[model samples]
Target: SFRFFQLDPDWISCLIDGAFSVGRVTAADAAADQKLHQKHVAGKQPPVVSGFLLRSYAVKGWPKLQVDGYKQTAQDEADMDGYKLKILRLAHLSPNVLLCLFEGDAVAVDIHQKPEMLHLGFEIPDTKTPDNYSKNLRKADGTDKDNYKNPWAIESIQPDPATRVVKVSQLFLDIEKKAALNFTAPFTSAQFALSMVEGVQKVRFVRSGS
Candidate 1:
């Protein structure tokens, strides 16, 4: 019926102070196209971009999403289940904008028949240690809630880095270009070897002409 989104606690004050408002990235469908699509709506609905999970690279914070407990339930029971999403950096001219980037499988939102009609739920993790739990247990229990011996403190999703993978292919390509410009190794050999080949060819041509 509802979905949970995790956000950093440090941004709480800034957000409450009206520093910036959250924006949703929706499908850019033309008014005419939207009307036409609505007319032909049937059993299966088309996929749409509900919104994006925003992360700011400017914040020196970790991003993480962890499940506390394991429950055996039918997949159909959930209206919308949790899934992994790829991090993408948006190119912006403004220096104030965050440049968060990630390389991995992108997540697509499910096409709901009447998504707006469904109830929406938003939750922010409460990291404060409850009366029953010790203050020292706050950080550790937040992550491993199910295993923790505490019964009062609700599990808080701590920040963690989402983009764990490095683009090795692109990294190698950049390194190759840099090495050639800096005259590092094999490129040095190839550059000089071509001169010798050209010299031998010129000598053979002169002999043949003679």
Candidate 2:
């Protein structure tokens, strides 16, 4: 779990509109969080910042999270897992997802919970090819392990962009955090699928658990 963040200080992956990054956490926590992108804030009023995901009106990147009332909450912190997020870019959508990035005033950490690995007993057509969140556990047969071939379904995808090589790493993190557990939320999984691939123009999610 080597969760990397704004290592350059000037770099921030935007959390969603109501989310903030959790800092000063442990490497183990960071590692676990990186491994699962799950985190909870432990303060009555924690400092909220932007995540690296941003859609600044000036460049190629993920959309930013909008914080309406930055300093009005008694318990200002949030369980990033507690809120729903969405990426408003229609152009970035595809039939097969590539990956997602966060780039604003955000700090993510790990939430402690024992999640069972869900087993969706079916195979996707192109499990070997990487979508936004696929882990390349390719075997000698050029196929992936069962888990890699089939991961937990994601609840929702927050659209962000990045040309960074590390983008895939971040995408994998997202899968562990969101998809592995609660895969059901208010989102069109079909639209998401269409958002990932090109030309085929349709998606109907098959049931699979992480």
* Candidate with best TM-score: 1
- Compose the digit string of candidate 2's lDDT tens values, residues 12-127: 23342113336525667556554443344223222333222223232222222122211111233463334322322223222322222333222332211122322222223345
Query: What would the TM-score be for candidate 1 when compared with the true structure?
Result: 0.16
lDDT by residue for model 1 (1-210), tens: 112122443354345334222332344434444454446642232222122233334222321211111111224525223433344333332332223222322223221122233221113224672222211112211132332454432222222236434343443343345322333345333432221121101000011111
TM-scores for all predictions? 0.16, 0.15
Report lDDT (CA) for all predictions.
0.28, 0.30
Lowest lDDT 10-residue stretch of candidate 2: 201-210
**Which number leads on lDDT?**
2
lDDT of 2 at 210: 7
For model 2, the stretches where C-alpha displacement exceeds 4 angstroms are 1-47, 54-122, 125-210
